[model samples]
Target: MSETITSDEGTLIQESRVWQAKGWTARVIKNEEDDGWAVAMYKDGEAEAALIGPWTMGRDKKNPKPLDHNAFNTLVKTASEFVRRHEQQLHASLNKSLMLNADDTDYKICLQIIPDEDDPHAYLSAFNNNGEQIAKIKVRPDFKLNPSSAAKWLEQGFQRLD
Candidate 1:
């Protein structure tokens, strides 16, 4: 239901929800000090955001460019493409931490991949049910888990060696 627009200044501004079904929403705020707009994307039921970034600005300084029909259409296309790429990256990261036990409920493991500066790799964190971190793995953006490792984990399950 929400949409994103890229300013002529090469900044990507998003003014829509990430997903209508998830109820995740976002708004673009212009920084007065800097000529940049900050996008805050948050889920409806959560206080924190799912994603945030700076949108590029448009060319021509006389007046802020308006979102006309053509501009709106182009913006939607560009923004959707960005969101799709991000979603794919997230999915690939999660797949690296394959679920061990399909029925066990006592121990739970989840993976979180966060982007970092100075490096293109994503910081992967393995967490336990109590939210305690189990392991941190720095993986390349395009890295994929070996099938053998995934199978081994599935058979052995997770252990709290810590």
Candidate 2:
């Protein structure tokens, strides 16, 4: 049996096979492919495993090695990096931004894609140096957000592109 831990966000964290850590849980489960064992690392509140790897066999050559603080810490770091990379990739895919200087003023142009099944679209927006919104327009999901494209839109008085 394993002990369950929870986070402050009301998320059911990891099931500690031996030692538990904050915002993380480690579990040793039967491998889905063969009769061997595998270790699973789960982040607090997430419904899916963040990292999964083969469990090392113990010195006895009969069972998996027991979890310890050192092993758990290493798993936490690896799993955290995995989650961070995933988030960065998702952000890059869904949003694009560019900064342009015109009339001695810097403005940030952003395009956010909303991939709704019924109606997919992208919202193009601009903000001044003060972070005040200048204009926002709904455009095609495939709209490109780049320096040249943004400069053209600014030259066109921020009008909707047909």
Candidate 3:
């Protein structure tokens, strides 16, 4: 059996095929897609891995290279960056803003999507040049906010939306 080390924090396993430290885990597993090895990086408390990639073969060319401090640090950096980019992209998709002019006054219009699994919806809001919210109303999640639509909505006095 492999040695198991523990501290006040959590389990810290440094073995030939698995490593866990610093709130992340890297495991070497047989690649199901080919006759090679793959490494998976998992964030602590997460059921699924955050990143997976090919692993280099060891001297024997039959086993994976043992996880080391340097390799694990690199894996953690790469995985963290990947997760950050994914979150930024998701945020961009969920929230959007645009500017339009109505009645000779400049206004900023924003549409934020609420991705509730049970009752997904969105809110369309208009703010004046002073950044004061002028109007806000519940809109469909798929509401398209373009110059034409926003201008029409403003023309209609931000009334009940369809």
Candidate 4:
């Protein structure tokens, strides 16, 4: 099921049914942007989103093709399935891998994923032993983290002063 919501910007957004998982929830928002519309899947009630991407544009540019009975039904099915797959992958990558290492006091590292608003990438930040940031990596969510790179950083043992 989906419902239309008016955002603070006064844009009319059609929101999909909420998909909930461990520590996270996702919902697809349609008609939320000027370019076309977007699907934003984020943690429940959080202002900062984990993921937000543009939805497919309709054939007509001026006006979106009306959602007829068949179209609306098909869209609901397809979008829901896609959201399910995305939720699973996001949970596995973020919840499983990224964390603050407490084992090595001299080389303590913290990893964070910050989603960008104007871009389709996430910013990965690495902080060192003193809780100071050392490096920032721009990564696509689909990009796999190179284990070699992580290992090399550990070997170098550079403590981030700031």
Q: Score candidate 3 by lDDT.
A: 0.90
lDDT of 4 by residue, 51-150 (tens): 5555555577643333333443444555456668988887655622333443554433333344546765544456666677777655564444455445
What candidate 4 gets wrong by more than 4 Å, as runs, is 1-118, 152-162
| lDDT string, candidate 3, 57-101, tens digits | 999988788888799899999999999999999999999999998
> How accurate locally, in lDDT, is each candidate?
0.48, 0.84, 0.90, 0.49
lDDT of 1 at 141: 51
Best by lDDT: 3
Model 1: per-residue lDDT, tens digit, 42-77?
Answer: 545667655556554557642233333444444445
Judged by whole-model lDDT over C-alpha atoms, candidate 2 comes out at: 0.84
**Tens digits of lDDT, candidate 2, 1-162:** 354545564534333354456677788887889867788888867779998999887788767887876888898899899989998999999999989999999999999999999999999999999999999999999998888999999999899877
Sorted on TM-score, best first, the list reads 3, 2, 1, 4
Q: What is the C-alpha RMSD of each candidate to the true structure, in Å?
A: 13.0, 3.5, 1.9, 12.1
Which of candidates 2 and 4 is the stronger one according to lDDT? 2
Off by over 4 Å in 1: 1-29, 33-62, 97-162
Query: Candidate 1 overall Cα lDDT vs. reference?
Result: 0.48
Clashing pairs in 4: none
Alpha-carbon deviation at 143 in model 2, angstroms = 1.2
> Lowest-lDDT window of 10 residues in candidate 2?
9-18
Model 1 alpha-carbon miss at residue 112, Å: 12
